[model samples]
Target: MAEEKFPINIWVNEERYEKLQTAGLADMCEEMLAGLKVIRVYANSAQRDKILQVFPTAKFDSATTKSIELLPREVKDAIFGKVVEKRSIDILEEFLGQY
Candidate 1:
């Protein structure tokens, strides 16, 4: 069976969109919420646990897309950076490794 992948939603502003565009990641942000573009980064359960431990404000919105939301801007930026750098959404392990 395929492994479960939990999502972490990152809202993209104009500046972030430009960066994503430059990185060729703009197309990945196909989802929109409240007029803002969004990219969903997938994480494993272990990574999600680490993230929740690291950022007490973060929560898993199981009712929605089963996404991890409410992360601080800086943390989101770091996750987005990993997305841009790797050109992929499967970045939770790498991002969590730092913490």
Candidate 2:
């Protein structure tokens, strides 16, 4: 068995921000980095982390010291919606064609 780990940082969207204030910087980072999709800071944050929208795995690169935009929930939800809408259909189609 082996132990694996990665580091990550998360922030909020400013412009056009309908962002929920989940947890503060520290708590957000902790939960977001740990691969938790929902973030409720101080047990009372209206904000939600969009992490699960893309990476349901909740895994991220905390170590990369690069400026990464905290993707908006709207954008993520839209993308997820599009993909999910077709995923089952695509899977069935592919399986049927394999015969």
- What are the TM-scores, per candidate, against the unseen true structure? 0.86, 0.24
User: Model 1, range 14-87, lDDT digits (tens) per residue?
Assistant: 98899998987788886665577888888888888888889999998888678898999999998888899999
Q: Which ranges of candidate 2 are over 4 A from the true structure? A: 1-68, 88-99
The positional error of residue 31 in candidate 2, measured at the CA in angstroms, is 13
Off by over 4 Å in 1: none
Question: Which ten residues in a row are the worst by lDDT in model 1?
Answer: 29-38
Candidate with the greatest lDDT versus the true structure? 1
**Number of backbone-clashing residue pairs for each candidate, in the order shown:** 0, 6
Clashing pairs in 1: none
